[model samples]
Target: MRVDKYLKNSRLIKRRTMAKKACEQGRVIINEKIAKPGDEVKPGDIIEIKLGTGSTKVEVLSIKDNVAKNQSEELYKHLKGF
Candidate 1:
């Protein structure tokens, strides 16, 4: 799935547009490399999102086109964050 979509579907960023903007500004990283909004994300991939002085890291656990708000956390495993 696209990184932006994954972020939104996973409820990490709350919105696809915000995720895209974050990617454009180089705030998103996957597997230690910078990620573009269209970057592909798969299970086991590491994703890090840096915002201001804090950041969040997660390991992709699954991908889906749509996810329930209550179940979004199942899409990724939190590795580290504020």
Candidate 2:
């Protein structure tokens, strides 16, 4: 799945546009490198999102086209948040 779509589908960023913007601005990193909105993401890949205060790291667990709100957290495993 595309990183932006994965982020939205997983409810990590809440919106695809925000995720894409984040990528464009280099706030999203994949496997330690900056990511583009169209970058491919797969299970087991590490994703790091940098926010104003800190950053969050997660390991992709699964990918899906659509996910329920209650099941969104299953898509990725939180590795660290600080």
Candidate 3:
């Protein structure tokens, strides 16, 4: 899945646009490399997001086009974050 979509579907970010902006600004990283909004993400990939003064890290667990709010957390495993 696309990183922006994954972020939104996983509920890591509130919106896809915000995720895209974050990526454009170099706030998103995957596997230790900077990530673009259209970057492909898969299971087992490590994702790090630096937003404002905080940082969040997660391991991709699964990918889906659509996910329920209650089940969003199942898409990724939180490695570290605020």
Candidate 4:
């Protein structure tokens, strides 16, 4: 999945556009390197997101086109949270 879509589908960010902006601003990293919005993300990849105050790290577990709000958290595992 694309990083931006993954972020939104997983509910990491509130919207796809916001996730894209975050990537453009270098606030999103994949496997420790800065990633573009269209970067491909897969299972076991590590993703870090920089928020206003702090950052969060997550490990991708699975990829799905759509998920319910209650099931979104299952898409990735939270490694660390700020």
Local distance difference test values of all predictions, in order? 0.96, 0.96, 0.96, 0.97
Model 4: residue 72 alpha-carbon error in angstroms = 0.2
RMSD of every candidate to native, in Å, equals: 0.6, 0.7, 0.5, 0.6
Model 3 is weakest, by summed lDDT over 10 consecutive residues, at 73-82
> What is the C-alpha lDDT profile of model 3 across 1-82, one tens digit per residue?
8999999999999999999999999999999999999999999999999998999999999999979999999999989997
Q: For residues 1-81, could you state the per-residue lDDT of candidate 4 as single tens digits?
A: 899999999999999999999999999999999999999999999999998999999999999997999999999999998
Expressed as tens digits, the lDDT of each residue in 1-82 for candidate 2 is 8999999999889899999999999999999999999999999999999978899999999999979999999999999996
Candidate 4 ranges beyond 4 A from true positions: none
* lDDT, candidate 1, at 70: 92
For candidate 3, the per-residue lDDT at 49 reads: 97
Over 4 Å off in model 2, which ranges?
none
TM-scores, each model vs. reference: 0.97, 0.97, 0.98, 0.98
The count of backbone overlaps in candidate 1 is 0
Worst 10 residues of 4 by lDDT: 73-82
